[model samples]
Target: MTDTTSTETAVRTGLFIGGEPRQTDETLTIVDPAKPGVIVGEAASASKQDVADAIAAADAAFPAWSALSATERATLMAEAIAGIADERDTDAAVLSQENGKIRFEGFIDALVFEIRWNLALMLADEVDTGKTLPVVPGIPVTTEVSYQPLGVVTVIVPFNWPIAILAAALPHALLAGNTAIVKPPPSAPLATTRIVQRVAEKLPPGVLNVVTGRDENMAELIQSPDVAKVCFTGSVNGGKRIMEMAAKTLTRVTLELGGNDAAVFLEDAVIDDVHLDRLFAAIYDSTGQICMNAKRVYVHRSRMDELVAGLEARLNRVVLGYGLDEGTTMGPLHQPAQKAFVEDIIQEAKDAGADVREYGTLPGGDLAGGNFLRPALVVDPDPSLRVVTQEQFGPVIPILPFDTEEEAVAAANDTWSGLCGSVWTADVEAAQRVGSQLVCGYVWVNDHGATRLDLRAPFGGMKQSGIGREQGIEGIRAFQDTRSIATIDPEALAAMAH
Candidate 1:
């Protein structure tokens, strides 16, 4: 990892609007989450006027951008993507410092953003592909059905995976011929702003923009009458707030919110070394900050001991430290508040007589002050415990044991969140049966978590988790509106009149 402290000047970021980098009188100081007192960078704190400017810029650019052919837009975006990798190392290191994720995960975040961008680009031709309907006896007219771009769009991303989550909608919106303004998470905006500004610079002025500021300054991004749609990926409450604000303009919204995903292991589940490794990573990767990571694990009562032993072995060997530290396997929780929240949840579980086993040791010296928490497993906790029932967006997870497949599925579906769920079993048929029964938007059979997610498939939550889907053809359509053109057919009209 690059030594961020080696340079005398800290990384400074500014808003990207109208293809220019603009500075703000007030700026947000971004610190290394792993070492909160150490300032890593600063981002322009967009004012209310700045937010309106971004929306106006996107609105101004929308007509020309939307007029372009899908192929033209795709070609320009491809050119921009080709240049994005030039600063990968620096960007990833900054992300690591600011987001409290291991360096490799930080690198993967940017890589995944590019991957999703390319994936969305691949669907360019399909954006303008319209279907023709033949004349019907009763209708007496032939019609053409087409998808048209919504105008200016606002895309708000969360702190956990800002760049990648922004890509889930940004590229698709732009490729579908809409102009976009991105609002990166306020706490971890430095690296995301740098990356988005780079991409925005290569595009047409106002075709893409980035604004970093407090939530209070961003009301216009959603409620502006010029804005056609808002794509937000964040907490459930945040999504609800976005919906309420957007409702003023009756703007369309695509929300990818929080999830308390469940992973079920059937009686015939494979608990081999490889499977255990995958399971461990699924539960604890990025220090368990991912929205889709398995928050609760439901194991067959027969294999509960085996699974617990395997996870314990892995947990005992974890190394917690700064994200850039080579020896570290897991970094701290992104913020001190989250650390406190997770600690409280674990204490609550322990008070309820659940066996809360925590592993790993915090590093000494300056690192001691970081938001570090040992990875923990709550063994066979009561289903009503906060760790089991709530979205524990931290490194602690609850493991519950069930006797029957019906019970496992019931327990998994009991949560208000239905984002994603997985079934683990050697029996493919059983995997299908149980996976199909889980009431989530996406289900994985035999494998689980973001590592196993299919980018080409649509991803989102059901119920309180989220309102709409992202990725695949469905994602592109989320940024668009359907239109129909019809003309009277003389012969068919005469026949129908007769």
Candidate 2:
């Protein structure tokens, strides 16, 4: 569990290419998000040349890696999973420093990646590569559908849940027989860097690679011809740029982008103190930075007051401090820019004559230098207000009242971003009826974000929220292409005639 890099690493913290660390002339200092004045470590600020090298390495390894049998790949994935387990504590430490989340959250994220990797590897053998066609009306031939991997997959990831999200795509990509060049988020690259270093060493050279850099280098990853497919998790604008660039090469792309997920409470929702904590955690956990966090809350008019009060009481209890502090349940926003963005949204709602309430107190001793903001709750805000209509993506929840189920559904589906929605009601059948009306990818009847996912179910977004899905068979197949193989033999045809 001892990580030397935690102490301002010795030299050579750079790109891990072809199973080796390659130093670069320029480097970026990773800062502790909770206390910006503190330095975590330095990583190579990869340039275009560095990106090209990584892509070349991935391209070189693609053939053999892709040619590996499913069992072989699964064996390697299991090895990589073991390697990751040994460094879980160290990696979680580094992740906590830059991610500005509690150690528990970082550890959970590390374990999340592990679970996902195992899921993909376990599902590897079950992936149906070839399926027989039963009779194609009037076609006197035996036909089979084959699933093949796209070559090199370039994964562009964001700071939030980098390891888990990368696992969502990269492990499955490898399971489908493809190499990967990963661009770890510059702001919080150390933990993932350590992960890839160990994983790459366990696998063949170029099978897995990691690079850290700015936007221009990401552009290189997108436009490179070596990449046959792309998986990106970031802002909507960034996803668009990746799509536009990948289009030049006709590379397949899967993007998990921004989401303004909504939560609804029917008249019979369990709003008692026992379940109120769950309701608040759904909205405020991860400082409300999660892509699918409950950004909008629509409650029945009778229960709106109770929901707001419960959320406010819960927020007031959150202890904001350094991520490493044991008392800290909620941590600061990832960056100053994000703090300002959330502040602006609160201000916009205020300008529109909405009553906004902020709770919690920042630590004056250790975390005063961090990008910390108390939770904000906008009550009865204007429906069109930015805080209500747009995705604030911070610790701000705006509760609006609905007179009827139809009105609640309309208000919930009114937003342009439809990633996820949850309906809270005691009546299972009633919740189902309301959930069915929601225009989102994943609809929860009684629960919100509790980290338990039914892997068989597809999860993603609708509208401008994102494209494509993650988790389940549908997700694994996104990295592959289908080919139809047909054969017509005179002998076989004669037998069929008989």
Q: Which predicted model would earn the best lDDT?
A: 1
Q: Highest TM-score: which candidate?
A: 1
**Regions more than 4 Å wrong, model 1:** 1-9
Alpha-carbon deviation at 130 in model 1, angstroms = 1.2
Error (Å) of candidate 2 at residue 300 is 0.3
Residue by residue across 1-498, what tens digits does model 2's lDDT show? 127425354323578888888877888888877876887887888888888888899889988988888778999879877857877877877888888877888888888888888888878776645788865535667788988888888887889888877888878888888899888898888788777777877889999998887776667688777788888888888788888998898887888888887888999999888677777877887788888788888999999888888887888788988777678888899989999999999999888889999888877875676889888899999888888877787889899999899999988998888788899999989988999999988888777763645555677888887888877678878888898988886666776688
What alpha-carbon RMSD in Å does predicted model 1 have with respect to the real structure? 1.5
Q: List ranges where model 2 is wrong by over 4 Å.
A: 1-12, 135-137, 489-498
Model 2, TM vs. native:
0.95
lDDT of each: 0.90, 0.82
Give per-residue CA lDDT, model 1, range 57-166, as digits (tens). Answer: 99899999999999999999998888788787777888888899988888888988999999999998899999999997698888999999999999999888887888
